[model samples]
Target: MQAAHELSQVQLLSVSIVALGFLYVSWTVTRNLLFSPLRRFPGPKIAALTRWWDIYHTVKCDKFKVIHELHRKHGPVVRVGPNHLSFSSPETFRQVYVKGCATFLKDRDFYANIQPGLGPKYSGLFNYTNHQQSIDERKLLQAKLSPSALRQYELRFLPILDTLVAIMKDKAELDLFAYFKFLMLDAIGDLAFNQSFHQLESGEEHQYVIDFNNAFTLIGLSLKDAYYGLQRVFKYAQTRVDAFLSEEKPKPGTLMEAYLENGKPKPPYTPWYIALSGHGFIVAGSESTSITLTYVVWLLIKHLDIQRRLRLELKNVPPDATGAHLASLPLLDAVIKETLRIYPPAPSAMPRVVPSRGAEMEGINYPPNVRFQLLHRILNFRLR
Candidate 1:
């Protein structure tokens, strides 16, 4: 009878909690539709009520298309969430992002969600939304990715490129997607740690590479899944940093090993934070570069005349030509940029929150806590 009584009490508590949750959601939805400042913005009534509408489209893999459609239906600005508006107008983008950047900070909630449990000390450059902190972090990391630093890492890529060419020679037909992904992963690994993944030689994906991809993919669906998956990536980076730091041999000047000045880490670059930075670096670099390269290759193949022109342009670039030499190649550079414009690897919304003081854009005064997002639609040039 005591056990039965306890079970009955537990059931009652659960029912009460669910009831409270429903009440809260309903109250918020009512407030959003009837009282929110963003209610003036153009969007479907359902979207103005809650963020679930946006999440649904995100999960359905059509958020980009859907957002563009919303813009078509409701001009350049469309309300995407209760407090969020998607901006595709060039003038609005320039005003909000370019002219009023100091007032428009990166959405704090979004960056906080990506790193999960980490504090500001562990927050990487990408996650540092504060204007000053972002500037400072960029100054610190900019050295590691500068022309001179990348030139050092560029040597490591040569052997890998030769290996890639050899692999292509052996296969009459091959899926370039995996190869491109592996190639960039290997390059990023060398740039992050003092080690190459050697995936081209092994012809297999590394666990670290696989986990990084998994974590990024699942991050959108569930924060819990992202946090755990990212933990694996963080752990892998830690292991690599540990091994690299402990090596008795002469250290290579990779991002990890380069942090040492006079055999000790520089200010704000302890082993753990170095690992965190490397985690950010790997996450930021790999897949996008590979995607860009793959699309460039595919587009070139489709337009063989342009490809022939590109090949002729490349022949002029000497085998030992540095990055400066490559940068000077007009057609080569144009093709890469054109490909990126046509098929952006990350064609999603990047949201920035309006400062507490509010913002005026294109004669509209937006209240604080409003999320202003930039979409790829801005890249399209209409026949004006």
Candidate 2:
């Protein structure tokens, strides 16, 4: 009789487990397919049901292309995830980001997930979710990046540009992309830290640069299961950053010195904040500028007519021309505009959250907590 009772108990436990699994599936299907607010938006059925669809594309480094295809199929608005909608139109982009129709706040959870182990302490101006906080942080470094300030930094830039030109002339076959990256890295290191990585001069990658590149690769691979691995990579980066900070002293007129003079006594710009900001300056500035310059150079190389016209335009300027002087060149301006339109450095979505009061775009009202992203690459493609 006792043996029979044990068998019955086992059967009951199995039935209960199966029932729970069935209920979960049913709820998920109903919520994602029928009950969720995003159901009305058109997208792939699998994406609506699971975040794994998005994660899969992200790991493949094709998330932007996947989103572009979705927009092409689904019109201006497409539901890329169960709760995430991507907008392709400029008007909607302005509404979401510029006009602040939606929340001005960034989606912290998303940004945090992008760099898993760093947490809020490392949230620099780009990733800061709080509006006031981001504004405050931007104020700290805005002067350093302004037009006049950039002109002063250009004095530092010309030498690096000359070095690059010399290196290119010496080598018949060279990787322009890698050289541009090295040039940008050295420029940022000198301008921000008052120290140059000498990547271009050394003709080899710097340790910090290699670490940052590895950290970024790890960040891209950071999905649900890879969180611990991402954390390990970030910890390595953090150690490098700490060592850099300990060894370097702030120099006059540079970003580090400016921060020390103006931001150290402040509330948000703590020691970690300063370190993170410095890290951001190197990574964001070098990577984006290098990508943009690489694209511009490639486009110029492919179109000989445009290159000839650009050369003629540049020939008219003084040999020691300043940025302000170059700004007057119409053809040069047009080339840059066209290049940026064709190949934006930041082609992926810039995610923003809908406010508690909600927001409307293109006559459709969205509920709060809706993750809205502008498909930047699609917009650029449309422009082309």
Number of the predicted model whose TM-score against the real structure is largest: 1
Q: Write the per-residue lDDT of candidate 2 for residues 1-384, one digit (tens) a residue.
A: 999999999999999999999999999989999999889989999989988898899878899888888887778888988888888888888877888933656877677744334445656645667777767666767887789988988888899999999999999998877998999989987776567889999999886666555555645554543545445434544554455456545444567655563434245355555555566677778878888888898898899999999998888898989999898899999988888888888766778898888877789999898888885678778622
TM-score of each: 0.88, 0.87
> How accurate locally is residue 252 in candidate 1, as Cα lDDT from 0 to 100?
68
| Whole-structure CA lDDT of model 2 | 0.76
* Global lDDT scores for all candidate models: 0.79, 0.76
Candidate 2: how many backbone clashes? 0
Q: Model 1 lDDT vs. the true structure?
A: 0.79
Q: How close is candidate 1 to the true structure, as a TM-score?
A: 0.88
Candidate 1 colliding pairs = none
lDDT of 1 by residue, 283-318 (tens): 677878888889999999899999999999988878
Angstrom error of the Cα, residue 280, model 2: value is 0.8
